[model samples]
Target: MSEPEELPQREQRESTKKKKKTKRSGKKKKEQREGEEQVEFEQEVQSVSECVVLHGIFKLGKKSHDVLLTRTKLTWTPIIPENPTGETGVPQSGEVLLQDIFAVKVKRRRAAGQESGGPVLGVALFWCRRKGRRLEEDTLHLHNASSEHTHTWYNTLKELLTGFSNRPTNLKVFINPSSHKKEAVHIYRDHVAPLFKMADIRTDITVTERKGHVLSVIKECKLDEYDGVVCVGGDGSVAELCHALVLRAQLDADSPEKPVRATLPLGIIPAGSTDVVSCSVHGVRDPVTAALHIVLGHLQQVDMCSFSSHGQLVCFGFSAMFGFGGRSLARAEKKRWMPSSRRREYALVKTLARLRPEDCQLSFLSARKSNSNLFVQRDKDQDQDQDPKSEGEESWVTNQGLYLSISIMSIPCLSPHAPQGLAPNTSLANGSAALIAVGNTSRSEFIKHLKRYSSSTGQFNFSFVETHAVSAVKIRPCSLIGCSEDESEEEGDLKTTPFIHAEGTTFPWNIDGELVEIANEVLIRVHPRLITLYGEEVEEAESSVSCSCI
Candidate 1:
């Protein structure tokens, strides 16, 4: 009986030990699955058909990594050594897109006393990473001891970079030293030039001394030597360049009948008080962002307007303003001795204080309207009766009245004052222009209208405001003595007289932030896809600052 009892106790102990071992095995399996899942989550899935260009072992920092180069990206995974248990550690892989890479060079390790020669280590990659609205540069180094391996990798990368045909290798840069607060030169040197150099881009830089220096250089310079033209200044400088480029194209074509599209694209670096053109193009007034856009070869074809007076081409511009806008710019030009911000503020306040409207006639050729009532059925019989050619003709709309402001914009004029742009409904290559007309309104109401531009909506909701999509516009300002009887009656009760120029006097017009004096009627026509600019389309422009002068 004692022996049987001892046997039972032994059996029970064996059973308990077996159960504990089973539980431990199950826990280990669960942990292993989770680790596998984590690795899968961290690694980008590769296609079976994707071709691997190169694979090698490289040292990253103190750890060895397995590097693989594919057609689209470069990936690196850390090598984890297996322990005595035959279990390996998980790997967290990283990758960089080939398109984001701007430059690659051989990394060298030099001795303290050595200045010229050094031993080849590996390759260093320079790239740009998007951070919020801007791009920041980053670098990665692959360490290796073999010089031949590093040279091979460098040559492969250089060949790959050469395949990007859109990237500009040579550029002509114009810097305006007098733009804004006189920081254009510094902005270019500190932000733009370094990026261009890193990308191995050759640039011919010209520091503009006077107002029209850029235009003169553009006219005489050998444009064939450059891939593009870069303007490092404000909107005026950009407009001047645009005009010069268009003129150069016309000269090259030797045809006055119609203007040809600009051959080379233009890049703008914002370093001014109001960088509307740059903001409109790049969606932000940032020099680094602009430089990156150019290096990456982002192209956007934008519509341009040709401003003509008395059948002579005055200039080519993206936007123009008359009436109150012109008066304010004119005032700002006179106060050149003051600081840019102060001058703009003073001009705005003074112009508003002497608020007045201009009597003018506006004739615009409207763009074809899309029928909003899609559900409505068209009468087949009526459609058959209409002439087919007549359907293609867009009718001209005419209106004559007292207007406080008139704006014709081919590109959305975006700035801090107007975050949504002065013409929010317009697009870059829409083949049309936004014609905004501000009819006669009280000073307070006009101020309200101006303030609404900073908001997202309700800008053109007032009864006195009108907006139209036009392809061409003709504006004729009526002299004070030539005003209609009803117009003269409307001006009788105003506390201040209308700010009208004397007979035969030149009228001020604000064309892309530059003041122009025109003595006769002006005609503006939109040319679609006229010039290629270095930027991407901006769906919505954002601004952290707002105008406080109001």
Candidate 2:
């Protein structure tokens, strides 16, 4: 009995020893990691007396423009010369308003005397009416007060302090990079970080512990404390931020107020393979070039699409990318999906294109879209508020269809590698999208047809492809038939099953440039001037066939 009692004590001691040993080992590993990290603290600029107000204008939906006012609050006394006649600068559409208010810390001593710690900052509201290319002198008036023009003394002070900023101060940056490209992190530190410092931009970097690490911080972190947010990857990184924004916008209810998002202008420092948003905004693919955008602070409002589900229909922001042949073959390989130590490689020729099936028909919205299998870029979308196509001249078929890509870009330049850009007639604020359709029978025909669309004369200029910046599309499965009528046969993919009945009303929808699954089909609409980004006027894309084929 005594021995048994001792045995129990020994076992308990052993268990405690094991736990202690494990804890020590874990702590050692963590310490090793900390010691091995070569990251050094870099000092950032902290304050600025003067600030420049950068006004960026980009259209979102058709006619709406997002106005960005960036500056640090300083005593702004626009030197107005003695001229009742005029002061010239502000655009024809804009009027300047100034308010005079005093912020005096005052206390009354039982109505006996005035008590004060300092002077009360008194603010007076002044409106400078615009007539032609000049502004009439600012007057103390509240007439025609709109939201943009009205502000309490407190808010005006906040705006003055936050909007315009000093070089390199009070900037909190979140850059948790997840890159397939191995060199992305090094590039950020070596090349990108230096440029940020040169701009006098102060930043605190947080390397991610895991996926969505940065996202968690963005969602809950006090955005008011930060002046701006910058991302450091490709479209995936931008997609992450967009997801955060979309999530926050819906955090309260189905549709929450967009929040004080201007304080959190999404900044991208591209360190990803496909830096779609970065390239599109600045028209430059290099990280250094991307850094320059931060200084410019040109707010451009690009279009974003929202997707949900419909009954037996698929929808998305841009397009549903269905790969055909080469593109399909490249993506179909499992190895390509895995992270590679080196650059992800693919066959120069169209190995993936071999999967293309000739016997296929495009069935959507009751239109029997069939022809020689080719690469087609949808150029325009007709008014959907039309009579449904009569079933008279229709033959329904589906399956063995190689690829279908759906997209609605506010601007034309999709990515740096995009062979074709948004249509010329299309506007960044157009509140629409462009569709690309590739229909080809053979690999040879597919390449030949696509070449025309990618050349100096892009898709809209080419005949095979149609480039339309439209609303959205719905995808459905139909009976597959042969080239001739009455030759319809049920293919495995086209077969009907209750569970997999090709009736998934909800699936993943691609927004911006990433894939996300929503509860319902998507109806991508351009939010009229929803956001503003730092940008310059984009030169029309010049498609050059002079380079090798895409």
Candidate 3:
């Protein structure tokens, strides 16, 4: 009787254990089903194609994850056995845009646990990670169990990165090693060169020896041999390169042997006292950001203002100014030995030492009337339209005044001092320039207007200031000739003569932060989309605070 009872109890114990096992299996299957549902929903939202998905395992630190690669992005899903349905594919740690990929290399490592096997392959993926104020490079290494599998993954990644666009293969880089806090060389080696290497771009780097050395090198170089020209310096260096390229293109156009229509595009890697171009183009003052733009083959057409004095191309740039702006730059250039922290203040003080208005005659052509000549096609018909009589008005509407300054800007002149840009409303390829003119005013009032540049609502608020959208403008300095009533009657009896000025008085002109030669008159013409720069579209420009100034 005791043996029979023991047998019955053993049978019942076995039945209970079998039931528990079945319940556990059912719970696991439910969790897996829910996880799959979440992954399917995420895949649908991401628009990932199932046909081209490449699956692999990646270990980031101690956590292991399963990764899926699409043509444009990589998504990683965490492999959690206990809590499969808790979190799905997280974008923060999972998704990486293919456009941000810089390089994919195969790294070899010892296979510790494998028996009689050679080195295992690991994929080292390097990419640009944009953090608040700058870019940080981040790398991820995925170890593969087999060498062949690692190579396959690497090849797949390479094709995906290369398939975005026809990226440049060879480039000519000009670095100003002595400028921009003297970090140009270090920046190139540390940030820019590694990126070029990863993109498989061959670079021919030329370190600038002197102030104007880049111009000569560019003129002598066979520009066609390289895909693009890069300047690793400040605004001045970029301006120099721009002028050289424009002059070279002009020379080629006049050549009877080889006629070229456009010049090579320019890329700027910011390293200088003032990186206004880089600030304006990339919306940041980071060298790595500029390098990424170049590697990706992003091209943007920027407006270039052509300045001629006495039938000679005196200067050309995206931004220029005469009067107070020019005077300030001149003063700043002279105080180069001053500490960087005090240089700006010193220059500002010197410029304001004597508030003297310049006697000048200003004239401009309305861009609204003739937009084609400024942007698209400078046809013969447009030239005919320049005739004042044909357009039912004077070709050049002249204004005479005692002026403070005239700033001609084609692009948004962004700088550390002016974070919102000098011409915040200006567009990059728009065939027009912001012609801001300041009339003679009290020193206190001028100070008020100047102070507005630091504030969003105040820059355009003053009554003595005027701004226009112009296609072309000419400025001629003149001597103030005060005529008394008696002298006026002696000379002419009919009409009272107003105080007039004589022509030929000269002052400085600032072209992209560089002081140009003193000239009696300056002529600036706008060329719509004249040159292509490596940047994003004008539509992607940073959105500034909007305020209405009376």
Clash pairs for candidate 3: 180-272
What RMSD value applies to candidate 1? 15.5
lDDT score, residue 110, model 3?
Answer: 49
- Encode model 2's per-residue lDDT on 1-550: one tens digit a residue: 8998999999999999999999999999998877665332111121222233433232222322333332322122222234566755432233232121112111112333644433332223322233322223332222212223323333544455334342224455556545646566787798667656543467867666666776687677666665566777656566666556556545534554232123346667767654655655665555655554554354565555444345322221222343332233233233555553222334323332232332223333222221221123322243322222334554333333434333345555534335344343444444444445453344444455545544545443334344433343333333333232123334323211111213333333344444454433233333333444444434333222232524
Best candidate per TM-score, number? 1
Q: Once superposed on the true structure, which residue ranges of model 3 sit more than 4 Å away at CA? A: 1-53, 82-93, 110-118, 255-262, 369-394, 481-505, 537-550
TM-score of 3: 0.76
Q: Judging by TM-score, tell me the better candidate of 1 and 2.
A: 1
Task: Point out where model 1 deviates above 4 Å.
Answer: 1-49, 83-90, 111-115, 369-392, 481-497
What are the lDDT scores of the predictions, listed in order? 0.83, 0.43, 0.73
TM-score of each: 0.83, 0.51, 0.76
In model 1, where is the ten-residue run with the lowest total lDDT?
A: 370-379
Residue by residue across 122-219, what tens digits does model 3's lDDT show? 78888778764455677877766577778888989997777766467889999888675788999999999988988789999999898778778877
lDDT leaderboard ranking: 1, 3, 2
Task: Provide the lDDT at 421 for model 1.
Answer: 88
Count the clashes in each prediction.
0, 81, 1
